[model samples]
Target: MARVVTKPDTLNQLNQDFEQQVLTVPVFLNSVPKCGTHLIRNIFRMFVPVNQQYHDTFIQIPVLRQHVGAFNYLQPKLSWGHLLFSDESAMALRKAQHLVVVRDPYDWVLARARFFLSDNFQGNLEHLKSGQINLEEILNMMIFGIHEKVPSLSDIYTHNAAAWLGTGTKLVRFEELKHHVQNLESDDAEQYFRELLSVLQLREFPTDWRERVRVGSDREQSGTYRDNLTNTAFTLPDQLPEQQRKLVDYAAPGLRNLLGYCD
Candidate 1:
């Protein structure tokens, strides 16, 4: 794993002391990769009344002191990016009562595929084509949903979801959001989410929250990669060997499951 770069003189003692300071309810909105984290950030930005700083990546979440520097410095609340549930993050979540919004594994992987295929991550292209990983095969799982007790898309999704679900953390699913929003219920996805912000005591919700509803919606249409993710080839007896399957399974069960498979 890569390092969390920021550290100061007497860093260990300082962080230990800081962690003990009993931080007020801080919002540690972990923007999961390709999980409509953008929409979530936008929604939170609407509620937080004061100026805030945000990062383009997850590296900042674990080292809050270096970037956000405790909630006391924050005008209202700060939204952050995808972070693994390490002790530093756990401490922040404990302080803030962070709400985790999880997309069904299928959709999660599909969105990731779009981002993965985009130009920003060109460095990964060589590895993927070399079979160090296979982005195309993995994405098909996103067309459907994760299945239990079997080989699936990437294993990473399944394992990752299991970690999130298994933890005592509070998680809300994207499906619930989609159904509620599409049905136009009184307690729609937007409303459900706004309530979380309120629970975190965000006095102001962006009026634009309503507008995000339209911008956030996605429908799975036929033959449309932009809409419908084509089913992935997770049933890998057809192409992948046992060793390869196990490799992917061990490295990325949650990722696989997110693509809607159980390998």
Candidate 2:
């Protein structure tokens, strides 16, 4: 489908793209879904109060173009929509420290696919289990970008690396830090927060935010998609048909191995 070319998406996307030219003034968080970004964003929001001093934009709707505009002066934290590598989004990503969040694609896919059953998704979030759609349609859409890349984060890893591959910025995996900041069994979570805070350069974290670091999440699990996934919840990678598997392999090779699925 051709893009809508509407004013806002185009304008915001364009603004976001332009803002990438600035330096370490803005730290871009290119997040793939289910990638532990919520926890990190919450920590940043809670630590850096949005009073007159700082502005924290985490998952702002419509587009993050407005927040990206603040790239001129150094801000303690900045978070937003995925930083795709289109000619439009190239600017802000170029000067960013390039901290991206990734998840095992298989698990991530399964977790989202289950959204069909949720009341919140309504009919638009179609699924065979929801009784509002056919399995073939969903499968076909997944195999092909049949409708659009609504759910795909779009070459985010490549986008982050394109501007600063050799630079000193780091990429964090969702799975690695899942328990790092939330498992309350030991002293590890505190140490993890200190390390994470140091990385974002936040001096003091809100007391509640610090308490939540090793506790629960800001929202319920996006894992609701699990109910409708056909095979094993964790290993849907193997259940995908051959063509689908090959297609996924072509689009994201690293993801196949990361999710531990056998084609």
Error (Å) of candidate 2 at residue 161 is 8.0
lDDT of 1 by residue, 1-263 (tens): 22221212222222222112112255656534555554455434434433342333443444554644434333334656656555665555564545465664444545555533433334423233344545445454333323642234443343333455555555655456556656644555556767655645534555555544443332321122233333322222224434444554455555545433443
- What is the TM-score (0 to 1) of candidate 1? 0.54
Model 2 over residues 26-60: C-alpha lDDT tens digits?
55555654455554554444443333112344433
The TM-score, computed over Cα atoms with residue i paired to residue i, of candidate 2 is: 0.59
Q: Candidate 2 regions off by >4 Å?
A: 1-25, 52-65, 74-77, 86-90, 93-97, 122-140, 147-168, 185-191, 203-247, 256-263
Query: How does each model score on TM-score?
Result: 0.54, 0.59
Model 1 residue 210 lDDT score: 51
Instruction: Please report, as a residue range, the 10-residue window in candidate 2 with the lowest summed lDDT.
Output: 2-11
RMSD of 1: 11.7
Say which candidate scores most in TM-score.
2
> Which sections of candidate 1 miss by over 4 Å?
1-24, 53-65, 68-76, 126-161, 164-168, 181-191, 203-263
**Residue pairs of candidate 2 with colliding backbone atoms:** 19-92, 20-91, 20-92, 21-91, 114-225, 115-225, 182-214
